[model samples]
Target: MEEANETIVAEFMLLGFSGVHDKLQMFLFFVLLLTYLVTLTGNLLIVFIVWVDHRLHTPMYFFISNLSFLEIWFTLVTNPKMLLNFLSDSKTISFLACMAQSYFYFTLGAAEFILLMVMSFDRYVAIYHSLQYAAIMKQRLCIQLGFVSWVGGFLIISSWMVLVYKLRFRGPNVINHFFCDSTPLFQLSCNDTQLIKRVDSILLSSIVLTSLCLTMISYASIFYSILRIPSATGRQKGFSTCASPLTVVVMAYGSCFVLYGRPTGYLSLEINKGVTLLNTVVYPFLNSFIYSLRNKSVKLALRVAFSHNKTKLFPKLCCAP
Candidate 1:
């Protein structure tokens, strides 16, 4: 009956790893801090190499760069706060800040799904339509695809934000989980959440399934085409090109489906906290390493880029007197 701001709890305490021993919490704080730094550096490095080196001036690298750019924002949304929560006695996030956190995280997460789908499609075109790959996935089209991917996430998540706002939160504002995730936020709502549950399930299922089906179809055609290659070496190379994105697709979708795909939300918040920890933190950290280490082109680009920088630095240092 009261106004929204007055009705809602002033702040929600994020019981992030509070049950753990003080020693382990401090250890976790440093570990998470280190992982966050590495994730930023690795993703940034990918974007930098892709931008500075003309050798990476292609549709594939452009998409890869967009993905790395997305990861920077995606991981940033939660890792810093989580680190603070680990060390500080106050693990509290204000109501509006909590909502903003959920909005941005899901928005970026959806963008990730779409961008990954676009990446798979890019691979499909590159392999299946090799003769026309350059013309088909040109700079103009790549820009358009990247634009759609980013904008699409904003559109998809805006509705979820609306639904979240409609729900009333009335007290006991201690969330058992680390971050302001949908399920935990849902659990806190005083109103009947059947609609939100259904909406959450539908939206999540639609995004995951739609992207997955498209990716599968692309890979299926790609597989058939790759096998049709007469040369054994050619076949190997074809599969090799797809390995990185496919692995990423599996990790991203697999974690979501297991953790948050249900109509009722996750059955256990404690386990949700654990798995989502891996999802939010470790996954981004791994994605950069996976892309750089697996892709030969990226490795070569890294070597060349760093070597050139080192050479230029050496000249400056030697001549400085």
Candidate 2:
């Protein structure tokens, strides 16, 4: 109602971390740059390895490659802007760009969240019901699952994007966080966002809570099956297969629980900014590290690739004598 009479703000200012200590912003810039580099490199490597190695052509690796691609898109959508904000005193974002930024970030992130649950479910099926794993997660089924994730993410975030665009920004135009999160975007609007916030809460709870519960259930079954392996070594190997994904799910959902579960007015902008940045950057880096270091296939692939490249480059040297 109020938005009908109000005009949309031309631009929004990102308050960012400038309100904090004097030189800490510089520190954050480099730290975040390092994080971005690692996240990009790691996720890229996963995609590369999965693509190049024919051994990784299973349904599980298919989902992993999609997840890896999603992370790269996710980081690209948010981190570059945040990195730029660190150096620029004026962190101004156009109304359209802000909406676009928030949309892709929300969409990719939600998809990744759901994708992780799917991956966990895949693992559970494999560990708990080895015979049915392939039958259950067939190529067609994997395609459907991936499609559903992308569709669900886009539809949900797009609805919010429309809701956000309709609001009038007659109030303060400064977003307290590094990027255009829902809370800060709503905060700048002249409209009463009570209904919007409620709708957001319901959607978030369903997505975050339901997905987390499913992941937990999958893991519970996997753990139970692990225990029945009879031999200690077999049990340990089974658990080790899941350890990395479990750790990532915990960190990601843990951060979301804190950031999203808070009352809109009660949120600490600085903390929310830091958490978002860390979540996007940390998980990708860790996923890359975990998959590369722990998975023998990936390491072996890398070693082979490297040796082949070296061999090509040093052919003349080898025959010089």
Candidate 3:
């Protein structure tokens, strides 16, 4: 009876596949390391390409580059620690550190989606208000939009986080998922969480739905305009502009809703981890390819950017001394 004492959880253990065999863990470590590097490389390359090539200075490319920049930091938040977890047995993150990780993770993620909505509206203007698009989406306006995307996502998630931070946490502080997401945090709390649950749900759902609905409306209008184009070349050109963002929107929204919107239990945490990896790691890697390969303009810009670099790097090769 004297031994029955509850130890407060000062730090949380990230149970990231601790039970897996050594061989499998090593294999996964390498794979994850490769994925993280590639994800960073891909997103960074896109941002670099956009920066080097002046032809990509338009509103569309600006948004794409903005997204690529955001994704670079976004992927960085969780992968390094995750990679460390596989290589070493010590997979513990302090309470404050864990809370901060969760905060930044959601903040960047929400910013990405909000930026998507901004992109959709950009596309809508490009198609719908064709003649006035340049006039409407001027440089100052673009900067403002970019500002809102980052700040808007921050504020939205911050609201939920404020209340979440106040919640009481007792012992047995092992996070089921790899990173410190809200779902596991809620599950870990000792206090009553129903009010907080509803708060988070309302916040997340509102943001996701608003962005989704706006994106749909924007795309629907864009498609309508494209279909009405009299010339086949004109229609094809119109469709090409919207292709990359549309693809990204689907991947982003699909993962978000499935992982966040639905009911979650310990049984589903493993599944959520897989989905989170896809969202953070694989998704960013795919985004770079999608934007660069699918769009002719980006591809052309990349070629020009690389050819210029090659010329600078080795003028003797071209000159043939």
TM-score of each predicted structure versus truth:
0.95, 0.93, 0.94
**Cα-based lDDT at residue 129, candidate 1:** 99
Q: Model 1: runs farther than 4 Å from truth?
A: 1-7, 263-266, 316-321
Select the stronger candidate by TM-score from 1 and 2.
1
lDDT of each: 0.88, 0.83, 0.87
The residue-by-residue lDDT of candidate 1 on 188-249, one tens digit each, is: 88889888778787888777789889988998899999999999999999999998899899
Clashes of each: 0, 0, 0
Q: Model 3, stretches more than 4 Å misplaced?
A: 1-6
For residue 222, model 3's alpha carbon misses the true position, in angstroms, by 0.8
Error of 3 at 38 (Å): 1.4
Clashes (candidate 2): 0
Give the 10-residue window scoring lowest on summed lDDT in candidate 1.
Answer: 261-270
User: In candidate 3, residue 103 scores what lDDT?
Assistant: 90
Which pairs clash inside model 1? none
